[model samples]
Target: MYMRNRTLLPATPERNFQMTAKERREEIWRLIRSGLGSQDDQARATGFTVSRVCDYRRLWKFILREHPAIADGVTCEEALSLAKEQGVKTKR
Candidate 1:
């Protein structure tokens, strides 16, 4: 595939989704709070599907907006960097 094929083509590498449920949630939260991309983008980064992103989109937005500081100390840049570092994949 070429870069023009997909704009949000992960821009990074691909990582494994070998995390526990708790870890997955945390990553999802991190991605959400990161504000790097939309829920679908985050889901793809965290090794999840767009459907999963849709499922938690509302709640995730609530937490990110209403709660704040939910991602612990992980900043948006940090979270995005971590995703890139982990080589997260987009199943497109």
Candidate 2:
């Protein structure tokens, strides 16, 4: 039926042109979270280039920096082990 949350990804050039980089990033995140299609398809459907869409995950790098606090007595090894135990699959 082609029905999805229309507001998730902006299709109009006018609206997309008005989006800030942060807004664009959020839209891409929403699109990926919905898992409607491959990144290329999602990008094309959302009026974005495949290259730009493929690089969108760079916007989420901040989460990696949120490693558990060492001052709180959590070592890097301990944090990594905990992350693995929690099923947090990091790609690097």
Candidate 3:
């Protein structure tokens, strides 16, 4: 099969695959809060699909807006627990 030259395609932003789960999550949150890109762009930068990016952004916004005290300190598990207790709507 004839393959096109890979170099001709636009380069993707470098993504850090070595980060721990927490570190990666924090980075995604930072990217979302930084307002440096659109949802799709942020997703691409973080190596996440757009839906996951949107989900994280929504969860972060909810935590900040509704539970400011715990927003910065809460872990993903804790956030999910809080969301469950508060009946926060989620797609999954």
> Which has the greatest TM-score?
3
Query: Which tens-of-lDDT digit does each residue in 4-92 have in candidate 1?
Result: 32334242333424666666656666556445576556756667677766545544443445446654565434444444565543112
User: Quick one: best lDDT, which candidate?
Assistant: 3
Cα-based lDDT for every prediction = 0.51, 0.52, 0.66
Candidate ranking under TM-score, highest first, comes to 3, 1, 2
Please identify model 3 stretches exceeding 4 Å from their true place.
Answer: 1-14, 69-78, 89-91
lDDT of 2 by residue, 1-92 (tens): 12344333345666777887656655666665455666655675556677766554332332245642432444334444555676665333
Q: What shift in Å separates residue 64 of candidate 3 from its native position after superposition?
A: 3.1
**lDDT, candidate 3, residue 14?**
42
Off by over 4 Å in 2: 1-9, 45-47, 57-92
TM-score of 3: 0.60
